[model samples]
Target chain A: MTRLEIDHLYVPVAGRTILHDIGFTAEGGSLIGLVGPNGAGKSTLAKTIAGLLQPASGTIAVNGVALDTMDRRDAARKIAYLSQGDTVHWPLAVRATVTLGRAPHSGRFGTASPGDRRAVEAALHRADVLSLADRNIQQLSGGERARVLLARALAVEAPILIADEPVGALDPRHALNIIGLLREEAARGALVIAVLHDLALASRFCDRLLVMRDGRLAADGPPHDVLSPAGMEQHYAVAAHHGTHEAERFVIPWRTLNAADRKPNQEGETA
Target chain B: MNRLPAPATSRIGTAPLCLILLGILAGLMLASLTIGYVHIPPGRLVQAAFGMADPATTTIVQQLRMPRMILAALVGASLGGAGAVLQGLLHNPLAEPGTLGITGAASLGAVVALYFGLAATVPMSLPLCAMSGAAIATVILLVVARDSASTLTLILVGTGIGGIAIALTSLAMNLSPNPWAVSEIAMWLLGSVKDRTFSEVWLALPFVIVGLAALLAAAPSLDLLSLGEDTARSMGLNASRLRTMAIAGTSLAVGAGVAVSGSVGFVGLMMPHLVRPLVGQVPSRTVLPSIIGGGALVLASDIVVRLIAIGPELQLGVLTSLLGTPFFLYLVLHLRRQLP
Candidate 1:
């Protein structure tokens, strides 16, 4: 029954506004995709929502508790955030890194309880990294590392999960598997939000879409409605073609155009 | 995959490991008392320890040897614990008190105290000035190496400051009017536990105890920081506060050790690297073991220094550097091979 709400959130970095007047709500058991072009502030928006960055002027609440009012540990218990490109300096084992996600649950002394150990094992199994549990994280392949990090986030067992490009470094098969995992989390009543670069995958996997243009929310609705050719052309300035295959809609962007071609066309005008 | 022998289940948490470390430390203290220039056999040492020995033996054992042995252990533990904290704070295994300028600053402070004829007037003045110098140098390093700087930059800055401090110390020693002062400074730089008294141990105990307590409190925070700053902050730690506490504590402990024993090397830098994997890479679990392990290493080296030389007793610092330099080179080579 947890819901994450960002109301009129405006985030600025070093005096320049990055995310402007953006708002969204992620209810439990929902999967929301945040898709945009480069420099559209998708990552910034996600970071702000995860409480990694403070908004310039806005309110972010989880389950009706304002983020500013909650202690860090309490907020962490509600929302787990996985950044885009994370690296570890220490060569910790897979099991050890996953155990760190239980920090919020563990007290100041940092001894893991039996319940914490059970959660870690469950997370490792869910991310399909149980076989490599003892492997050093540094020795893992890129896809394997990504899955390990995802497992760490899952170990938090927070009601809301925010991942910024979690599958960007994975292979095609691994990418689909991660998306499937996110959907599974959502089905289990966790609110899952992911910022993705691949529009086709986003459309196929997400239950809802949030499209951004220059730090503003350009469209928010079902993927079928918000991912139309007109919306793509308006937000990305590219020509797109949409088609139905095997009961799925696929979107393909062909090319961008010159400034002259971007003007409104007259009724009698020829190409 | 050859699994790292499952870290023995008994040593899983910080509390159990801490207790085991204390037990080992107590045993090592007793062993240190038994070994020395004159092998007062264990039975005699224990009888001497209980104040039931012959007058001559009691004077030699209780009056001279026991205090020196305890001083060596205390100095070793302080240096080792401080070194672990510094390394964790900088996120660099190479960071140690000597390399990071705290030792050099302390040496300079001691020399300055001697030049002003303060040591003869007030014995505690030397250690107090040395602690102040270490604190100042640590603060300078922290300011120069801001929160966002890389570990390499921090180490480079520390080296630069340390070099300046050493130069200043050498200058002070050379310009002193008293030849006795020059000789004293030289001996101090060589680092020894010889001729130390119980009063000197008491002078150092408070700083070391407080510094170690501060470090232990910050151990869990250091574990969080190993994941990197952003992740640490997201997990509810104030990274800057943790770093400051660690640096301050290291300075206090290292400064006091330097004041008492001169610039003892390698204990801090080597102990954590050796015991970290044994404790499952948790910084919190590593602190106590590092302290005990550090004390053991120094006391053993001191004993070896006493026994090895034919004429003059070799300095403790020289002994550690002789053993540590090759191990350090091996580590660099191993790290190079591991890096992509």
Candidate 2:
């Protein structure tokens, strides 16, 4: 099975520590959700894993190979990263854009092999963007653009997928559809780590959750256990409404807990 | 709802487009050879190529026009390829060697060479000095914007350098001792490929070849970069390495061209945009066509300069600017909507 290990990763942005002592181990066949409030270092941690940002200290590895030491092409072959709010600078065709996902395997001049074309075709079909293949990316609707970009990442066919806010700004139906795709990717034996803002989707669909608070991994466990009432109140400083629907558990943030609402012992607990 | 608009595909395929561009370049190059003041017919030109023509015809074709024509092709290819690479790297359609100050710095270097009377006395000093100026500007821009993490910083620094170079050139013009010196400087700034010899051709050829090769190698990486830096890096692109290669290549190719010919503008800026409709918007794919298209445009412009023969010859750079400015203004006016 494909495995990702981030050990005591300390990432700094502009010389200020953003992700401190963050560590996690993720394996294939599970959907892991990374959820946190604004500036909680979740995206920072994700970027570090994607190799966009180097860690200030500590290591990130896949299987037994150190990510820092591995050939970038080899690393790219193993880990596919989908950035938040991705924009295409040029008005490229959707098929051509998705075909860029095969950059690592296509070599220097990008002559697509038969196997590469098959992978791109499969990714286009999987993300439901096959019909829009000939359309320009600049003409795509926001939801359609999101799926096309997802198709680009899926074309990598990597063993691990790291997506930051994959469903950001999407409507409910599209968001649920994207989340379902991630779950399906996990079922197909790819390790999928997605940063999500929606607690309901995170708790209901993820096999595990990694909660971030003040640049630390505050909690890590199955979503149900990690989103306990006390855990939610402690890390998120909010009262969560919990319920079971169709035999699936869900947690929705019902109200913000201000300094005045915190118990004496919990007062000044936020860093 | 009405059906969404689709992207326009090339009615002509890439291979066909490239072949057409090549044919145009060949036809233009041939026209460049024969259409000078002393017109040699195509049959005589063929004999001249093999040294079988009369000495006068052979001397005119082999000695004079050949170097000038080669220079035009080299300068044009440099500007065109450099422009496409800069546009792709900066993710801005407007980026070019002229905009990034490399061409301006090269102009300043040539001016300095002329100011000191170094160009008249020394055989290769003019181009060498101009190339040095371009190299220095490139190094300063790269070093100050070391990260390549922020393209904005690189562009801002480049603009500042370009402004400084133009100011220095103006200062040189203002302080000239005589009207003759001033006119000489002004004429050089207007840019031309007249009366150049094989020496100039030999000087620029290597740098242009190396520089264009570097840019062509960068095409695939540039394609990946159009998706944004973060995504490009995630796909194993060594972005800093790519940036260094691109800027250095621009300096060498464009710097050497500026050294040999003066500042030929708009060819670099316009060719890639013109080639885009035929090649689609992929940055890498736009490169080769831009190179060939650039060569064709310059050769055609040079031929026009020769054919005009009005009073004195029209400036090559002046003709390009006359053509390029309208296209540039159109781009600015329609900046809101992304065009193919």
Candidate 3:
């Protein structure tokens, strides 16, 4: 079954269209990378899917249910979203913050059940922050905080996990660890969709890639096909060099030019 | 199998802490009843409590001192709970009732009510007016701040509004027609629990109860909010709705408190900060402790106020200001040091 479906999604903010005719589908247990530059509306699309922002038009569906029709709590149970930046006021313990993911399942009085506690502990373990469970979140380093946030989302145990630049602020090792964790989640039958800026990471870690340009999907396919030199030149106006390193493919943007040089770039004259 | 580690109780749980606080509150209640200028014996106070004392002593204890003590506890608790909620919502430890201007607005309302002779005609009318004023001011502040507004903007705007409200209150007090109106307004502004009767306590209780319940209900939401707005919303909690509810609930509780006790400061601002670290910064746990601590602080200050008076009683506000100003300065410096 398709775990998430976006059909003709249009999003506008402040009278400016940020996303137009954007659509995609991620089947269950798939790791999909959403790749684009700064103005590609990647975060906006993620927010719309999470129901945090209303689309200007079109529809988003999760498990064949229209997102607009479902209650926020029900949507929350099915999908968990982790944004690019988070601000925490109080210096809460890591365990305390992660336990907040079970808020939807908990009653109005917010008493965590046995199941909730187990989920929190499991998430902390999965994110490898169990040793720091009692430490204050604010006292942790940036990478540690990012892992803690991932643990918080993991505690939700939702089938669809949407993370926008989840590893943007982390070191290379921590970033790779987070990508590995997301892959593990996908292997466990969760749809893991991450909006990422690192083309090399996307090419290596993701099973499929969706390239966006100017608020529209430019290409969608396996990484080898979608990240070709020709596609990169045509859509991104940049030349990409792809090579295999340590049994993994890496894509790097090497140069940029106008449409006049597109033909030569596509013909591999630059190489 | 290894025995499951005993449920961590290094920090006291909510229920036991509540019981202990209730016990302390009960003791304070009895102490408030026993200690006075007339020095009613503890036995006599207990007898009066049980309705076994002479009518005169009974009147002095039940009708005079008992009501004032109850009002003090209620008002103190309300201020403390409101402060915790506000601080959590604003995500700034410096955010407090005084900073937000809810108390100033309430005092202005009370002064207006007094000037119009409405307080004399109806005892509850003044508190009602004060509550409405508080609600209006809070709504305006929230509307202006909106969802995306920064904490700095919220505090700056709140401080500006608070200053304006205080100015208006001073103006109203100065312009009163009755010769006693100025003194009455001055006394109300300064804050005191002296010479109060049961009638005033009854007038304020319902509002306090309703407001406190609302604040308690918002406790869990406040905890989620401390994680910040976007996180809260992504967790299926509506941040705007929670913020509105918190502000409204706080205004109602603090407004009633101000209308009755006349702008008692510091309790609302200081209680939450004093208890948050102790309770691990969880809003759910901070609520009761702040209440207990606030009550204790205010009651202790009130006792001191009574003890130090020579001819006429000094206002509780005066005592609180004298105690609180230094703490406020320390907080300002501490917050500056902690800033990035």
Candidate 4:
């Protein structure tokens, strides 16, 4: 029942346009992966959708109401965002850190209600950090801290969850663990938008993919269609190996595109 | 009524810690009343406290000792609370009024007022000017380092601002019209609660109360900020509003303290760190305890000044600076070890 619609969105930072004419419509019950190379405005787009950045133009409507007019608390209650490499400044207890996600619903004074407590507990459980709840957040390993931060985001219980590079800089096992958690959240009916660098994981796990290049949306469709070899070379400048594992399509970037790899007809146009 | 799980490392509950600190503060206040120059016996101290004793004893207790004690507590509490709030807001353990150059800016402002002879004519101008200076410093720090605010940038910029303010204060003294003005300004800069009357006490009380309340109110939002700014905002925190409140509160509280007692450095910096271990590092929980701990510290320090009976009565600011400089160095060394 949750719908997020963006139309003709333009985001400018320091007079430089970072997101150009971006528009998309997403709803609950699906996992969407935002894929692009560095400086492709993937993070910018995620931030705009999460209401962290102000779009210079266009409308962002949530469930038919324009986001511009929505109360800050109401918007917060609907959208949970986890920034890339999010850090805890203090060595706060893990449970205390997760409990902060209840701020939007905990009223002005931040008095915790029973529902807030329940939500925090459930989020801790969902993110598989329940055992570390009593430990100090700063003392945790990077992977453990990632789960704790994810738990903080999940504690919001929002319909739309936006995570920018949620699994970056983690071991392969921890990365898979976080991706699995994101999938579970989507399966539970939240619209999860994750900015991912792993093409194989995106292709296998994401229901849909939105590809970005030079601050523009290059392609949008099912990952199978959007992550084609031609699209991969054109957008990400990567020559990828494509195959199917157990009937599910996957993509692996084999090597960076060089001038010799391009066909004669495409050679003169661009790299 | 609190349900948040206590930190596993926490030795005592926050509530009990606060109560114990409060008890200690109360006991210290009582002891302070009895141990002054007159040495009113504990039995007579109670009578004087309620205004039932002879007029002279009553005057000594109510007019002299009471205002001094209350002012110390208020100033100390504001300094401590401001430090906790700033540290949380900036996500920097080194952020405090002293380290951030706020107290120096406030001192410069008061010194300016004294230099121009405005304080003698218009007493309100002193705190007003001091608060204005502090607000300007806070705004400058925010604007100049708005982007990353790395430790290097914050500390360097703060040192620059503080250095400039202190140098300017010295310049004002050098250009003073007479020896009396220089001596008066110099003595005030040493900082003490000596001879403070109810007028000075009343002047600082409202600002301290309001500032402390603002900091306390903003404490919970600070907890959100620990997750970083973008995440905190997504969690419905108004980061800009929080910044405004923290700046205004620090300015008012630190300014008022400086106006009455010159610049009592390092109370803000030390109190939070001292109390942080007891209640855990959660910013909100750290705040109340830091404030109460600050009150206790200044009260005890003021009593120590009286007990030591050093030459010229040992200015409170000088002692704290003497103590604080070493603590600040230790903290810097500690941070270096931790980071690398």
Candidate 5:
């Protein structure tokens, strides 16, 4: 298990800063959800923390080791990142694709070990892609392909798993299933950070929620605290309806907030 | 007893297949040496190889056929390995030197070297110029193909660059000083393994070996790269670094090949397809087999060149093109369904 620590992390693309002084600490054994609108820098924060994008002005540490100082393979052994996209370059078999997740653990020759095969099988079962292991990835449907990719990440078995919008555009059932799988992964003592747009799913599965607005962590707390009516109105620009079902909290976005609902500044009330 | 558990990804039994291909390649090389119109028997050929035969037979087997066969093997293996590397490195199956116009650059470079009267003065300068051309074109390709260039963009850019280089080579051929030189240029441009001397092989082997080594070193990284650049990066790979290594390796292999053979087409593009089904699509495992399969294909083509002899005989490049065009079309048609 590993703990991910980010202090005043900044990511700048071109000249403008995309992530500004973002700070967060995610310990192992939790499914943490980062929720925000488009362009809210959730992906940036995740990529930066995963070492895909180098943080411009702050430090990210994996297992108390500074990420910048770590080797690429070492950093990879600690963190597994699944970026949200449609990507399967070759028509590789599903099992072969999942085996790529063991790249960091394997030697430079990519020779497979007994442990690597075991991890791949376990990941295939956990992601529910074992049935499709022999099939070509290109032949699988979008949902199945996504599951295979998820299986690939799970095969990494890294202590810290950061997935950027893993369930975006997935059907409700598959989306819920993916989140549930992440929850299970957290139970295995992996620090699973998933970026999600669905507030209800985020509220349902995430042990803690990190809300982002304009490159900043607008709010961070339990789903109940971060998905509150005012919290949704302030950071998400949506008015949410809070509900309880089966001893768990679920938040629903009723409507987009109009100008009338915008909180007035203390200095001046133009409206 | 030594055994591994079930494979982590690939199917079993690729080793025997690789050995079979190696056996085929060896048999073909001997057949290439023995089955020529010269008609040296296998026993005499072996005797000649070991310095136990008459001087005349030794000269025919050793001095003449041996170097040409070795050169063909080197060129073929280089194309095969380089082709596999390019496909995995760029994650584009259609990425091969002949298709991507690197061959045109190499041809243009060799022609330019010859046109400057440098080949007559310095034999090594020809391949050096070719290497320079390949390296320059690769640099241009990298600059033109930003990391995010789409497949269409890569194809279109490759076509555009290739067209310009071919046209320039034609222009150089037209402005030649004599008809004899023009004819030589035309025959060379058609791409043949005929009349290949040992000296040319010596000139190219070092660079081609280096190129093969570069591609082999990057094989493992390419397996990870097959899963998109972002995912590859997340696995602690620097995509740009891998990109540089792959291109450099290509320049070395294809540059030396085009330097000697004058732009033999499609061996690099075609070898991986032949080897993939047997070895699975894992980049690292496929590389050596691709090299072996490439050597087999080119060696067979050289034999065919000798078999169908009228007077001047068919060039090796012409045969590869004749066979490769249909394969290219088949792949493109399949690619049409696969691409969005």
Candidate 6:
């Protein structure tokens, strides 16, 4: 189990602040959906947490250990990251791609151990890619390729898994399948964080939603609380029809809202 | 890469295939020693090789043929292995060893050494100067080109460096003291393995060995780099360290190669691509076979040059270009649909 804490993180790229004073704590065994509008710094925060970017200020700690103090290989063993769609540069075999996740666990010159092979096998099985293991990554469908990358990350068996838009181009069914896989990872005691664009999927699957707007954490709470019409209007500038049926709450964005017309008969409540 | 059975299984267990290539390399090396203007019989060749034959045969085999053959093989191996490293490091199929200006820099150093009569005055000065030039080129390349730029940007920067170095070399030749030195520079620029000595072989072997070792050690990193830079870093690969090893290895290997042989072209660039079908596209798997294939290509080209030339021997570099350009174009045309 891992505790991932990003405290007062500020990230700058090219002299412009991209993530400002953003903070989040993700305990093990929960699926976190990071949501945001376009250019809202979600990917920047994901990359920073994955150690692909260095923050300008504040710290990221994994299980009470400062990320800055840990050796890169050690950190890799603790946190596995999968970038967005088509991150694979080589046309590697699915099995070969997944096996690369064992890099940090292998011996000198990446001589694999039995444990590593077992991990790859388990990852393939868990990601439902065992049958595609022998296929070329480039030849696979987009959704299948995404699953292979997921298996690659799963092969790491890290306590924390961070994926930046893993399902961005996936169809709805594939997206739901992927979200369910992340939920499974969380159930298995991994701190799973995925940046998602589909609000309905996020509300349906994620245990918590961390919403970002213009470099700030606009909302952080259960989906029901974060997807309220007022919360959505303030951050997203959209009006949505929200309803609860039995045990489920769903948000359907109906129209764009202007600032002046946003308040309703609550014009009287303002007094 | 070895943990699972790769989908590209033709090269899965490649020991036997590499052994066959090594065997072919050995055969070609022997043929290079035996087949020339004066053909030595197999029995006499063995005697000449072991220094038991008459003085003339012994001199022809031990002194003349031996150094040239060894140097050709070494040069070929260095270039091929270096090309493989470069392609892996940059994730570009067009990434040749000379694409980063190491060979051009080496050529500049050698030309300067020749113009100053340093090569004639000091036996070690030529290789030393060439290696220094290569090192400088690598330093400049790293400082300028290895900064997360797009692949095309890196290639363009390298081409600019090569252009400047080449222009300077031509300028130096234009100002030569006499026509003889000018012609000599011109012929040397065409690249050959003629009249090389055992001492030059000894001078270059260490750098090639060191470069090969460094690249082999960094094989795992190259594999991860093939996964793309972001995932490679998240996998705990040190990008700076990977780039350093790659650049250092290419510098030593190609610099030493250019030092011994003037500037043999295309063998390094062509061998890896040719051997990929046999070994799959994995960079690590391509190293040994490409090295062996490179040595064979050099020996075969040298043989053809010797067999066809009636007066002056054809330049090894010229033969390679004639042989390689069409093959390279064919490969690109064939792989046009598949290339990234």
Of 2 and 6, the candidate ahead on DockQ is 2
The number of clashing residue pairs in model 3 is 0
DockQ of each: 0.32, 0.56, 0.43, 0.56, 0.47, 0.45
Instruction: Compose the digit string of candidate 1's lDDT tens values, residues A1-271.
Output: 9888889988997799988898888799999999988888888888877778888798999988899888988888888888787576666778888888898899887479999999999999999999988877767888888888889889999999889998887889989988999999999999999999888788888999998877888889988788787776666667777888899887777787555656464122111
Name the lDDT of candidate 3. Answer: 0.80
How does model 2 fare in lDDT?
0.86
Looking at model 4, residue B339 earns an lDDT score of: 47
Which 10-residue window of candidate 1 chain B scores lowest in summed lDDT?
Answer: B1-10
What is candidate 5's fraction of native contacts?
0.62
Cα shift from native, residue A172, model 6 (Å): 1.9
lDDT tens readout by residue for model 5, A1-271? 5778889988996678998888888899999999887888898888888888767789998878899999998888889999887587777788999999998888776478999999999999999999999877877778888899999999998999999999997888888788888999999899999999899999998999998877888889999888888787777777888999999889999988766777864112111
Residue by residue across A101-198, what tens digits does model 3's lDDT show?
88867877757899999999999999999998987777778888888989999999889999999878788998999999998888888899999988
lDDT of 6 by residue, A32-144 (tens): 98997888888998889989888889999998999989999999999899888675545567888898899888865656788999999999999999998877677788899
**Residue pairs that clash (backbone atoms under 3 angstroms), model 6:** none
Give fnat, all candidates: 0.30, 0.68, 0.49, 0.71, 0.62, 0.57
In terms of TM-score, the best-performing candidate is 4
Cα lDDT tens digits, model 3, B218-266, are 7778887766666677788977777767777887788888888998887
True contacts kept of 1: 0.30
Standalone chain B TM-score for every prediction? 0.91, 0.90, 0.92, 0.94, 0.93, 0.91
Q: Report how far residue B21 has shifted in candidate 6, in Å.
A: 1.8
TM-score, candidate number 5:
0.94
Candidate 3 vs candidate 4, TM-score winner: 4
DockQ, Cα level, model 6: 0.45
Better of 2 and 5 by DockQ: 2
lDDT of 3 at A213: 79
- State every prediction's TM-score relative to the real structure: 0.89, 0.94, 0.92, 0.95, 0.94, 0.92
lDDT of 2 by residue, B196-247 (tens): 8998899788888998998888777998887888888899899988987887
Q: What DockQ was computed for model 3? A: 0.43
